[model samples]
Each structure stands twice: as C-alpha cells, then as structure tokens.
Target: MSSVLGVSVGAGTVRLARPQHGGPHGFVPPYTFEVQTLAMPEQRAEEAAADAIAAMLAAAPEVGATTITFRSDPQARAIRAAMARRQLTNYQLVPEAVAAVHFAHATTDMREVSTLAVYDLGSSGLTVSVVNARTSDVYQCERISDISGDYLDSLVREQQIASGRIAHPADPAGLAALDALCRAAKEQLSNSNAVAMPSEQGLVLLTQENFEALMMLAIESSARMTRDAIIRSQHPVQAVLVLGGGARIPLIARVLERTIGVPVIVPAEPETALARGAALLARPAQVPQAPAAPTILPLDDEADVTPAWLTAPARRRPLAALTSRSGQNRREVSAAALTVSSLVVVAGIGLGLGYGPEVLERGNSTDGSQAVPATTSPRPTQAAPTSAAPTSEAVHATVAAPPVRQLDNEPTTSAPPSQGPNTFTVVPGLPPVVLPTLPPVVLPGFPPAGQ
Candidate 1:
C-alpha cells in the first residue's frame, strides 16, 4: 500500500496533511503541520516553503506521493518547482476551492449535492467559491475584500487607544504587540463570553458581543459575498462549507448561515480539509504498469528526417543533456585541487623573493674569508677617585685618567670630557632597554588582564 502527502499553501501559512489508515473516511488526513509564510520576495518565499516541506518529509519518510493545493497559480508553480528540486516526483496540483469541495464531498453529506459553496476567511483576505461537486469545477469564485482577521484586530487596537489603555500608541513596536494581543483576544472570544487583554496600562476586557460589533462590517461583507457567489453559480447549493484561520470566529459562521439561508457546516479540523482533499486526490487509483518498448521509426531513402530546430547550424546540446552528477563532482574536485596548487605555488614564490637577499648574505658569511665586524658605539665612564691630601701629587691624582671603561675596546686618544661637581655621568648603554609591550589577551568567559 502507498500513502499520499498533501500540502496547502495559503496567504499566511502552509499546511501539510497525510491520510489516516483505519476509518471509514481514512482518506481524510488527521495529522498536519503548519508553518507561517515568510514575508519575503517570491523566490525566497518558495525556498522557505521548500524548507518546511523538507522538514516534514524528514519526520515522516513513508509518504510516497504528494499533491499541493494552492490558492493562486503562481504560488503553485513556484512551490511545485521547489518540491521537484527536492525530488518529490509523484505530485500534482489542485486549486484551493476545488480541493475544499472534494473535502466536503468526502467528509460531509454533500457527496450527493450537485453544487456547493466554500467561504475561506484567511488572514489577508476572504475568498468565496461556488463549485460543482460532481465535476469538481469552480463556477463562481470571488475574493470579497482585503479586510480580514487583521482588520478586526486593528479595530480592537483602535478601541484600546481611544480608551487610553495604551500609553504609547505612536510607538510602532508597542502597537504591533497590542495588535497581536487583540488578535489573541479575538480568537479567545470565539469560545468565551469575554477575554482579557493584558497591556502596560492594565487588563482590558473584551466581550464577545462587543467584539462582534467591532467586526460587524467585515462579517457582513463576507456573508454578502458568499451569498452572491451562490446566486451567481445559478445552481442550488445543497450545503455551504466554512473553513480557514479567519473563519474560526464563531460570528462568521452564524452570520453566513443566516445570510445564505443554508445549513452551514464547519468540519472537524476544518483547516486541514484542503490538504486532506488534495491527498485524497493524489492517492494512486491503480498500480503502475510495466514500461513500454521504445518505438522505432523507419528512415526514408530520399527525405531529410531531422527536425528543423535540431538541423539548424547554431544548434547546441541542451543544458539538461550536458549535466550529470558524476561530471559535476569531477569538475568541482578538479577546480578545488587546481586552486590549492595555485595558492601553494604563489606562496612559495613570494617567500623566496622576500628572503632571497638575507639568505645570500648569511651564505657568504659562512665562507672562511674575514667578515666585516659590526660597528659599536662608545659608552660614558665613571669619575676617578680623589685622595685627601693637600700636596700637588694628591691634587694631580684627583684629576687623573678616567676609571676603567665599561666596554672591552681601548679608550680613544681624546681630551677628558668636563664633569659636574658631584654628579656622575649616566652610562649610555647601562640604562635597561625597555621592550615594546603587547596588547592584553582576552579569554572566553573571563575579563582581560590590565594593560
């Protein structure tokens, strides 16, 4: 037996689903994983989506086939290329609305209904679609408005600001946090009579009735669009299916039900319905057959058989034909080896050029000829000792030759230098030579030593 993987790409999130094995509606998937869509360029978004799917596939390696249902054609193509690059071979595309209809047919009593409608209230916008259940064809699909869950959250945020609950309403970050809180409160109000929103000011209570009142216009607009789609389809819709993240609000369903005058149904785990439907469609109806034999065409004696494009003078081999895994690997290895070898040769040449003069001088000095001695500078000497006598001998001895020189070289035949009364001359070479200091070293998790 084989299994199918279904993926649904929405404006704000991407969801994955796979069928369960043991129920009457076993084709309907129970497992799912959702990832928020990245707010990036088109190409980056596709890459992000591919990364998410790859992660899911890594967790569940048994999925043999995949079906990706998309809200738009461009997204479908981009995501399909992403999956293809990951080698997900057995996959197909289904429109989001059609997938929803397929899901309704399989999971609900709408299987016998000829026509059905689906209202998908997403984070960014609302989509209303009327589909023919029998043909899986969408007859009328309309995007109601740009207003959505985000708009509702903003309304709540405005209310907070007007009530002076947010001190710094002008701060973008603070406003963003408040908007998130408002969205959470809106979601909570779906199941509770009142939800508390915490802020810097204090706890702000939002009742379900007030929340619905704040979003009344958007709710009414969505309901009107659903009703319009049904009427435009020109067929009686047996049932209306409501699903999406935005549709989680209880008021949306009640309003739609009252407006359309049809029994509106919110399926269990409705968010996964589109993905599960795509997975159901992706299930292989029959096993693969054996490969067919290659066809051999007869050659004509006096006719040119080659196609015009292939026979053209400027024709070149296709890029796909020129590429192969082994060839690419061999080229990459050769390039790396060449780079390393070039770097080694350049480094050797540079080192040789830099030290050539010094090495030659050392080698010449090693030969036995007398080498020139390095020049040396003279150092200052200490004062001579004086004898305590009043005679001419003692006075002459007091002004005698300088004390023994600090160096081994003989003293120069020059006049004695003048000296001060009680100070000794500072020896030029005797003062300790101070070496240059290095910067202190820093270690991880420790402070550096003092300079």
Candidate 2:
C-alpha cells in the first residue's frame, strides 16, 4: 500500500493531492473536498506553501504512506525547512525543473535525451528550465536558466500592455487572475472554436486568432532561448520536449518546432506533468544513494553508439567506381614514385663516379666482359631512361684511332738514338716503279754464248 502526496501552490489556491497506489484507474474521490485558498498576507506567499503539504497529509492518512513528496518552486527551500521542523521525515523535495523531467521519463518511455526545455505557465508566474533527461538507473539532473517560461510570460504581458488591452501597468492580483483565465481559455480554445471568458468585467473572448497574436511574444522568446539551450547542451538533442500546463498550447508547439527545426512532443495530462513526474521520482524502484549521474554517458562517448548521420541513408558510391577513381590517382602516384626512384638511382651513379673504378672498367663490365659487377650500376629497365644522351661507341673509336697516329707522326728536331727502321718513316703519296724482269730472265749458259 505505497502512497505519495503531490501539492501545487498557486497564487489564489493550494492544490493538495494524494496519489494512491494499486488503485484502479478512474477511481473517484472518497468524499467531496475543497482546497482552502489563503490570502497572500497571512502566509507571506512563500510560507503559505507549507500548508498545502500539511493539508495533503491530513487528507489521506489511511494509506501506508511511507513518503510525501512535494513539487519545488522558488519557495521550496523555506517550505522544506518548515516541514523538517514538524519532524515529517518520510518526505522528499524535488525542484519543479527536475519534477518536470521525471514526469516525462515516467509517462514517456524515453531516455538519454539529456536536455529538456520545460515551460511551466501557471496562474501567477511562468517557470522554464533546461534539464537533463538521463536514462540511467541512477537518474542525473542539471539545469540551464535561459529557456525559462516565466520570461516568456513577461514578454506576453508587456505586449498585452503595449496593445492597450489593459491599463498602464498590470497589478499582481489582476495579472494572476488574467493569467488563470487565459490559461483556461487557452485550453478550451484547443478543442473549440472560441473559448468564452465569463468575468465580472464583461465577456472576454479568446479566439484562436487572438491567442496566436498574444502568444507570439511568448513563442518568439521561448524559441530564441530554446535554440540557445540546444547550442549550450553541447550534445545533439534527440527531441524538443514540451511539458507543464503551458505546453498544451498549439502556439507554443509551433514556435518550438519552427525554432528547433525538430518535432515538439506533448504528452498527456499536460497540466499535471510536473506533479506526476514528482510522484514518480519519490517512489523510484531502486534508489541508490551513490548512483551515477543519469546523463553522464553521452551518446557520442558510448562505445556501441553510432551517430544519426552515420546510421541514416548516405549517398553510397559504387566500389567499382571508387576503385576506378583510385586507380586514376594511383597512376599519378606511380608516376611520382618512378620519378623519385630514378632520382635516387642517378644520385647513386654520381656518387659511384667519384669513388668508383675507371670509366673503361665500368664500360667493360657494362659490355658484359667482367665477372665482377660494374662499380657504377646500370639503370633498371623500369627506371626512368638515362638523361645522359647515348655515347656512340662508333664515333668514339673513330676519334681515338686518329689521336694515336697523330702522336706517332709528331716531328722532332733531333734524330733517333738508334738508327732503327722506325727512324726513317716513309711517307706514302709517291709514284710506282716498273722492274726489268724480261732482260734478266735468260739462263746463265745462254747469256755467256750470246756475250
């Protein structure tokens, strides 16, 4: 028989709620009860908040209520301290910002959406918070102040005053009542043609058109802040979540959608989202005192996580096409590699020339005469062709043969030391001589008889 109490303290009234567990849905209240609305003077506005908790405990004491949890507001700290003085130990306090996030978690089966913009518009003031929607067993929480709904309300109020629908300045009491009326009218307008406001100051009509205009300021203000919050989260947002009573307004959703460029989710019982969310936080299944933070494990930081852009359909190029492109680039790279190899080979040849054997030995080995390899290596077939023009052996032999003759024919003033046949060098270019062979052909005896 686990039970918890939820209380909401507004400007003119305090709502005392007791949620009974294991009870069938659509269960009616035990008896007709009315919430006591206290004036601001007696409770000093902040102190009056404690009465709501006291009233809830008084309402249902039969249930085995182990804990009583209340929604936190600006006045939470003071109210909580007062509750502690009364020795009400089985109670927990949650900020409205955290309560709203808990509400989204309990009702909606979403987690790891670490950032949420909660816009709470009530009878008096609006409250907005950017909270972490962590999905871990030990829930984690954080808040950014920019996306507050209260600021939007002020914008709307200023716009309304500028338009001269109200007097110079709106009193607190008048603003409270008007906000309450506008809230009711806003809800009614959601499902009807025109929500009529029956008041002492005649009938004020809130049509969809008028609501849109008045809500524009709130929307613009909220949208700007929402965009800022998304940037500050430093994590990609899975959704643009809307809760609390004001979240039901269509204008609010439209503005958020337009600003965030994402879908705006509105869950059921928008008015009670924070209260229900607080109730869930109070009665968690496993409350670990030293549990890890809920949103600490970012999607980007997770080992098994893949980014949305990575998972979504991409323009996949065919492997063959990519290979072809790679081959084209590869050809260019191969050319570069060949050029570099050639340079390295040329450098080796130049270095070998400095410390290597004579050019003749290199030529002999190149001509395939030496068993030992040439000191200056030949270029590989695949290597770049030698830049040095081919030295024609025919031309070289012709030039060398003439040089040897020129050295031998060089004239000297003094004669040779040895009168060798080499000393009288005969020069060719002279006339030819004929021999008298026929006259001398006679035999020796015939020559004597003739004489």
Candidate 3:
C-alpha cells in the first residue's frame, strides 16, 4: 500500500496508526508516530471513522500514507464519503481480521498457528473469530452479547456500592459519572494491585483479586462461546489472539487458556493491536502463505458429544454386543448325549427281564452237579421260585442279576444259587407237567445272546 495509516473504529474507541515521519514544515526533528485516539459511536462507527480520518488529515497534511480497515458495507460507504469530502484519494481499506493476522506474522513466531482465534472483547459485546492465518478468511465467528467492557464496569460499580464505599447516585448524569470512574478503576486494576477512585460518598477501592472474582463468570462464558466456535469451525485452533480493552485484564487470558486448553496470545499493546495490524496492512509487506488449518480431528475442548460406547463399534463390540451362542451350543450337545444314554439303559433293562430268570432256572437242573457261582444276591434280596399256579397279565422274569464280566470266549455252565437269583418269580401254568428248554432270545439293535 502506498499509504501507511491504519484505522480501526471500535464501539468504545477509534484507533489510528501510521509510520514514523518528520514534519513537512520547516526543519523539524523526526517523530516516532503521529496518531490520535478518537471517540466513535457504535451505530455510526464507519461514518465516524471517515470523519476522524478527514479531520486528522486537515490538521496534519503530512501524516503521510494512510491505510484504513473496514469490514461492512457502511465502512466502504464511509470511506468513499470521506475521500470525496476530503478531496484526497490516497487510502486503502483492509479487512480487520486479515490485518490482525498480518500483524501477528510480523511480530511473533506464529509458525505453530494456521488457524487463529481472535477473541475481541470490546466495549459493547464480545466477538470470537476463527480465521485462516494465510488468507485471513474467517472460518467461524460468534458475537456474544452478554459480556463486554461495559458489563464489567457495571459489576465493579455495583460491588463498590455494596461495600459502602460509594452511595448510589441519584441523578442520571451522576450515575454516568460514577460508572466512568468505576470503568477507569477497573482498567487500572488490570495493571495495579488496587485502584482507589473518589466517588459521591467516599473513596471507592477495588482490588485486582476482587475485580477478577466479580468477572469470573463473564470471562468463563466468553471462553465457552469461543470453544463452541472452534467446534463449529471443525478445525483445531493452534492459538488465540486476545484483543480489545478487556484483553488488558490478565484474568481473561488465564481463564481462556484453562478453558480452551490452548495458548491465549496477547500482543504488546492489545487495546491497539487491531489498529497497528491495520497500519501494517497499509504498507507494502509480504503476507506469508500460512499452511492450511490442520484438521487432525474434530475438536471440542468441552468435549460435549455423545459417548462413544453408545453409538460406535456397531459390530462385535465388547461392551455393547455380547453373544450367547456358545452357551446355547453347550446346552444342545448335553441334551443329545442324555437322550442316547437313556435309550441304551432301557434296552439293557428289557433284556435282563426276559432272560435272566430263565438262565437261573436252567442252572438249577438236577442232572448235573456243579459248584455254585460266586455272584449272588443276599437272602433278603432274593425271592423263591414256584410252579403251583399261573395267574398273571404277562410272563416275566423276576431276577435282578448283577452284571458279570466275561473272562473268556468259551462256553461254560455255572450252578445256580442255593435259593434263587430272582427278586420274585411268576407261577407255572396248570396241566404243564414238564417244561422244554428255552433258546436264546435276540432283540433288535443287539448282538446274539451267545456267540
């Protein structure tokens, strides 16, 4: 830029900056800077900015190259109007956020910053801006109306009144005066441990600790809003730049740093940072192409998102998706094994009922004498065999034989017990004098009775 004047017209103050230059008249010594503070209104800020610049030029024609910053349509209109009225055309308007980034690049080691959060705590309200460091494009921004310098001033005023240090003013003019006094005290408290101001009733004293205590909630609210802006931007912010008069209060940076979990950057002159940055833009300087905002992950310092266990890992998640298939399989196999064992038991019981008693009777034959078998039930466990009568629903063997282990594959006959192996015996039929020998009985799904 051919001009070197940077102007930022804020709600509470108008900041102007230009390079150092010597006076155009006579042989004057060179001065470092020729800038002035102007009172600007919020609604007509742009128009006031134009008026102020024109007035400055009128006073000092050699203020030299001038650069102004503007953000809205009204600013442009105001600049055009100022130029047309002043009969001068040596000015350029730069975006305010872009100018601040330019200042950051010039002053500090901003290599770590790609996305910058400009927390401007001005008089009327707070504006949180997430801007790209390279192009100075705003990615996300928010205007918080609840907190501001004026609000903090009110808090100080109320606390001072409550302490009995000052009586509440009766008239509007007096109230305004007291408020102004409190505002100054608040600003002083930023740099000093305590500030004492003369008021209506007495000297109102406010300490730095007390001031921070009174404004803790408001600063925390600003931090919360800033965190939200970062989350909405969907890009991680490396650092934050604190601007405006409120930035002078050290507590704001501490709370913001703790809450946002990032560095809160404050320049040498925070109240005039924007103005100086604009002034830098008014001059010809290299604007570094900062790397693209790093998007390592979605960042929410508050981390107010749905819990991961509730929605993620839809397949085979250890916590949410437990399977019972193995337990069910084990139960199914046990049932099958129980069924096979039951069938084998029933078949063995049937074979014993049909043949055990008959084998015992054949062993009791009188024609051959032999030693009795060692296997026998106790006398109480056995029942006597008889052949007197037959009255039964069906024929049955009454012997409950103990299982015997076969030692050899040879046929051998064993003598019956002296009593009998039967628990109970069925009676023989009438008119049946002799009984023939019974052959071995074969049942399905079994080997022959004798090999």
Strongest candidate by lDDT: 3
Per-residue lDDT over 265-371 for candidate 3, one digit per residue giving the tens place of the 0 to 100 score: 88766777777777665544335898899555676888646556675665447644345666677889999999999978865774554554544544464543322
Per-residue lDDT, model 3, residue 95, is: 65
lDDT of each: 0.69, 0.54, 0.72
Give per-residue CA lDDT, model 2, range 1-451, as digits (tens): 4455554544434444445443212233331122233445424544565655555566656423322223344456666677676655556666666666665665565654656666565544445455566732212223334433344445444545565554432467777666555456667776786766655433446567876776687568757765775576564455666765567677888887877776677876565555555444454233459867756555555575545566433424465678899999999999999999997886566455442232344355444333334374644322333354334463344223321212234563444344433344344433223332444456766755457
Candidate 1 C-alpha lDDT tens digits along 223-329 = 88778778877877877888876767888888988888887878766666777777666755457899999767788897666776684443544544466766898
Question: How do these models rank on TM-score, best leading?
Answer: 1, 3, 2
Window of ten residues with lowest summed lDDT in model 2: 24-33
Task: Quote model 2's TM-score.
Answer: 0.48
TM-score of each: 0.57, 0.48, 0.57
Q: Cα deviation of 312 in candidate 3 (Å)?
A: 67
Q: Which residue pairs overlap in candidate 2's backbone?
A: 103-277, 128-149, 140-294
